[model samples]
Target: MMTFNARALVPTIAGFRDEVLASRTACTAAFAAALHDTLAAKLDRAVAALHEEAETEMRLAAGKGTEDGDFLYEIYHTCTTFEHLWMESGPISILDEIYEDVVAEGETCRVGLDYTVIPTEQLGEIGGILDRIRRETGIEFIAARV
Candidate 1:
């Protein structure tokens, strides 16, 4: 089983947000750079594992080379292409959950952010979350898949 240490990035993300909100532009930029570094390292390790799996399958298929050679070749090509795109774009799916709290005849807004690095087949889940967030929060969010 593959595991990701997502907790390690929490502090970096929180610090970045805090610095940006504090109006410290340079510090915010630096923090963002640092966050990107962490993100890249984590993503690289995940992609490497995926590449290894794809290569292994490809090798097995090559040895067979009976009637599945073309299919296996196509599958291998697709996997590699997906890995390349992810590495180049650093794609992530982010969901912002917003809620309105009404108390003392006044309303306050609360927002929560959740995100994940989507695998190849789960791309639709990201879009679904964005749609739900917009409907629930009445806020239009622009999300990038990459």
Candidate 2:
């Protein structure tokens, strides 16, 4: 339930960038865990695989600034581009539904109980979310980037 005060913290570019990263991680994790069980598992696996692949590609990029260092990114991109037409043998994906949320959303959907969500007129939307955040901290935010 810990959260940084956005206006108080995200004033500089680096702060904004870091806030975006944190928000992406937080929002995405919340949104994903709320999806259908099977789809959620699929998403979890895909994100992990993509993250590992991205790290490898980034490492290759870091080895040398030249395009010749390695075609790691290109190779992965090409494989995906041709995935449906041809195939390369690879590991099978299996879903092992583990304990829920790692941080905010713990073992249940209550991870976001203390979140600072903006109110919207969308379906299933809860009211007073932003007010809740404001009242507790004595801070009013007209706009929060995240």
Candidate 3:
């Protein structure tokens, strides 16, 4: 398993949180506008007894809320994406079942985490785990000064 030190994730997670916080207001406004546009289009087509299932589905997906009906789910998700790392209390095992290349020792001394090296799917999965951890503990992870 590829183990990652919690400190290694600091920069990427902090950047994600900052980005979400920065664009939250704009994202919310854009989502509302897109939803309104979709509804208008649907109404227009309804008058002619026609509908675009794909277009409606796309709009709904884009505007879908979080588990608790939060409109800015993406922002919230990004903001809490690295919560797991802070609370891990141990190194993160990327491949939990495998132990062929575990690097449990000297993990903290490593530099340049480069989170972008990880595939998008795996990163999203990690983010989901972090989100769950935050929700369960009701703790917001804040960056520490080095």
**C-alpha lDDT score of every prediction, in listed order:** 0.40, 0.33, 0.35
Report the C-alpha lDDT of model 3 over 15-128, residue by residue, as the tens digit: 444444443434346543342333233223322221233333344447676553444443434433233333333332222211133356655433323232233243332334
Candidate 2: TM-score? 0.28
TM for every model, in the order presented, reads 0.30, 0.28, 0.22
State the lDDT at 65 in candidate 2: 50
Model 1 TM-score relative to the real fold = 0.30
Better of 1 and 3 by lDDT: 1
Residue 104 of model 3 has an lDDT of 64
Top candidate (lDDT): 1
lDDT of 2: 0.33
lDDT of 1 by residue, 2-97 (tens): 222223334433443343234333333554444334333443544455555556655755756566776665555553443343333333323222
**Clashes in model 3: which pairs?**
none
| Residue 65 in model 3: lDDT | 65
- Which residue pairs collide in model 2, if any? 104-111, 105-111
lDDT of 2 by residue, 19-121 (tens): 3344344443554223223333333443344455555555655856567665554554454422211123221111232223454545433121122322333
